[model samples]
Target: MGPRVARCAILASAALFLYSCTFFEASVVPPGFAIVYGVSDYYPASPPISGDSYDLTYPDDDAIDMAALLVEQGFDVILRTNEDATMTQLELDFAEIGSRIEANGGSDTRFVFYFAGHGYGDGMDSVYGSSFPDAWDSYFDSESGASEPTGSGAFTEQLLLHDAMPINSISVQSVDDVLAVLDESLSDDELSDLLGTLPSSMQMVVIDACHSGGFRGSGTAADTIPESYEGWDEGVSVLDTLDAITLYLDYGSGLLDVGASDVGERQAIVISASGEQEFLYEGPVYGNGIFTHYLLQTPAEADRNFDGLVTANEAYAYARDQIVRVENEFFFGEGKFVPRVSGGAVDFVLFEAR
Candidate 1:
């Protein structure tokens, strides 16, 4: 071949190789660390009564169990549970987790935060609280006669930002509260300012509840429901803003500059059990939140790539497919479960190295 032709061919080959390495088949292996927090029963209150009312205590248990599972796999874990553990306690735990991860070498560390409990949301933003029978109206200050409204409880993500955890994945199994916090936390420029301090890689959030309060019988069963409940309508908009954030981070200027890379390509992945208009079921046999049940059960089988490591994308795809299949087999429903994800490729290994 002529010199000019040979040069062109070599350049083309290099371009193809780079593209394959960056996009087609890229794998990341890193040390894993995690913090799991679960709130089964609220403090200063009796344990939640099962059978009569929905079992509101499972999420916390699931979270603890997941943390333990991670620990068994070789992850450094921080686990906490119960009523005495308020939102503040949870925040403190996350701060510690973040600090430790940073000290251990932030970029090299793969951090995960898992939470399970009652979550409340005001359509736009939601929060996970320490108790069941969450009084949305009372907390959001929607009821005129209610005592001073306390905003939704602390979001674990916000706490991580506060503590400066760099590059992590956060999986939460609260209802609407999960979405609410994501909506609000990612929107607030101040919150972004705090997050900007962390090293950029990827952040994943998994919410297991319907965004719309309109699920046929969801809030109707409780007579003492708070006024803030009004804001939760069925079919409310999905938390699409997260998607926008991912796109912006991928192409837009960095968090510091409009034209330069500011936050690195840090991604935020959100997996919700249902759309804003749907309902996520929690049957007695399911033993835990419907989404959580599916998540715990399905991904184990979907590690199709057999990389011995599961990325955020792989896990969500597995959960999404299995949730729909199981829901169809059991409920024969149109769309009882859905898992949505945003952000770039993330490294989320469900199992630790033995």
Candidate 2:
């Protein structure tokens, strides 16, 4: 069956199950938690434009859709968009988030944050922006046709982290610039200490960007970076920066060793659209990026083993296989495009209430 049809079936089954349960006797599941942010346009000091303007649309849409799905599964979600908000507003929103977390009594809360927008990297850092201005310097001209910013730095993840919300999962549809900011945020030991301060829960981060190789333009979706960005290079990988941040925090404890399984105890999963040697592509149908499209369309039932849950590892495995199958069937039949997921095992439950 098509994805839409499969989704409908799942919804129907869920509704029936909930309806059949005794009203008062029914077990109450704690609500899932979420905070969503989407930035399409930028302000006066924005980054350079790339590809096409439409690239901004999909990530925001993905965030909304994800929020809707979470709501369907009984989550209490707060969504923010760039259209009617500003960066200062986002900061305030995050502060409120911290308050809410404290009020909710963090123990049972499972906070998730999602961002979809442009990302860039500096020589030693990566950044995520709401619009081209934040990601590229080329778009900073007075008459430049780029989106206006909401005053929030292109990267808002650190701000959120500073709010001390105790987030469990963070899914970012970052471009190269945003990744640079993430790297910078982690440059200090304070950020690492903040990460360490959180409860021992599963954490998941999903990034979609082009890093290397000739696979850059194979897809069909629009990009927000300018054609002039064809030669732009931030000089660092978001993953590597994250690793560095963690290493700095490890402080000779060897806790941040690469490929170490125990690291799963704290931060758990990272799903990247392409490998370190490949660049993620945007296709027409996929809208945002090929990897993200596959992730959203994946059927919950695909977790055939019925582990009562589908971890990030399982989701990535499924998405990788499917992305390859689709790519081969359509675009790059002669070439292979494989998405990747790093870190260790993470709990990513799908059929559970909330």
Candidate 3:
């Protein structure tokens, strides 16, 4: 046969072989890292009018367990729980994750980020908090037909850090400016004390129960919160969230240092405890957050292909099903903890659980 005819025959034969073969696709777990955060306690509740009464009971345990799980899977884990989780610290941790992945080399670098705690999603942004609850205003606004006062800086979603941070008062500045607020030694409460130490003329901006003030930028020092921070997959980049309730605050002010976040796209995979619009469940049943419990405990039967390796898709389905079943048995039927998974293809190897 002519060369062209022979080539066509070979192509057809190869296609047939591949179609007939039942190969178990093998995707190994890449050298990766993870950042896990969960808040079991929110010390400062929002105003009584806000109606954020319930404090999470399992996030601290969730963080600890998730970090351990990642470590078992051979991932470098950085864990933060309860009071240690502040907006500033969270942002820095994210940057550190990016740095670690880059240090290990980019491109094929893998990452798994897990958060088990309080999360709120307005029509636009999903707001996550350390231990704080969303305010009543979070539920409604003029755009949603509420008669409440209108304002700029409306958001689609944001992850809240620290405790009792006003959605509007969140900082949205550059990482440099955010870090400039103070050395990493300053805790959220210390941030408040930092303000107190400032000249009386300088205002203060509280980030959480630990910190309760804002800076107007009167002093030469960089302002914290409500500045500019970019990076990340979407929505508000850094802090720079609108501090809408400023009328009641004594913060001076800070700016988000200009520039993009240095943290690369380290969030290769994110396993949030709940969907953007839902709240995660925690109970004594599994002795941990609902999603987290299932994540670590789903039967090995989850290996649908029985290839000895569990893909992320398989693990997610298994965990989600188990979470629903357990939540229904123990909690109210109406309240569902819909776990969410985003970023990267679902076919990646999540765990080798052989």
Best by TM-score: 1
Sorted on lDDT, best first, the list reads 3, 1, 2
lDDT of each: 0.45, 0.42, 0.46
Which rank order by TM-score, best down to worst?
A: 1, 3, 2
Q: Give the alpha carbon lDDT tens digit for every residue of 1-354 in model 3.
A: 699999999999999899877463655556766667776665354333245443667777877987787788787788998778766776677677666766774546455555555543333232333332223334433345322121112222234444633333232133332232223223322322322322222111101111111111111112121212111124443332332233113223323322111111122223334432344444677787666677776435578777777666677678767765555555552354444443222346667765
Candidate 3 least-lDDT 10 residues = 206-215
Off by over 4 Å in 1: 1-15, 18-28, 43-57, 123-200, 209-267, 297-299, 332-335, 345-354
Where model 2 places Cα greater than 4 Å from the true spot, the runs are 1-30, 44-55, 83-91, 124-200, 209-265, 286-288, 328-337, 350-354
List per-candidate RMSD values in Å.
11.8, 15.9, 15.0
Q: What's the C-alpha lDDT at position 282 in model 1?
A: 59
Would you give me the overall lDDT of model 1? Answer: 0.45
**219 in model 2: Cα distance from truth in Å?**
32
Cα lDDT tens digits for candidate 2, 1-354: 699999999999999899876463633344355566554443323323342232244655666776676677665667765453344554555566556665664645455544444433222122222322323333222222222111101211222211111111121223444443343222112222333343424334454444211112111111222212322334556654654465455534655432221112244344545533333455677555566666665546346566344556666677777866666455442134565544322355432411
Per-residue lDDT for 1-354 in model 1, tens only? Answer: 699999999999999999877774545556666666555554322232442332354766677667767676666788776553454565466567667767766866565545555433332233323332333323334533222111111111221111111111122233354333334222212222333443424444455544312111110011122222322224423433443443355343444222211111243334445543344555677677766776665436657677666666676677767765665456533334365443334445554222
Backbone clash total, candidate 1: 14
Q: Residue 205 of model 2: what lDDT?
A: 48
Query: For model 2, how big is the CA root-mean-square deviation?
Result: 15.9
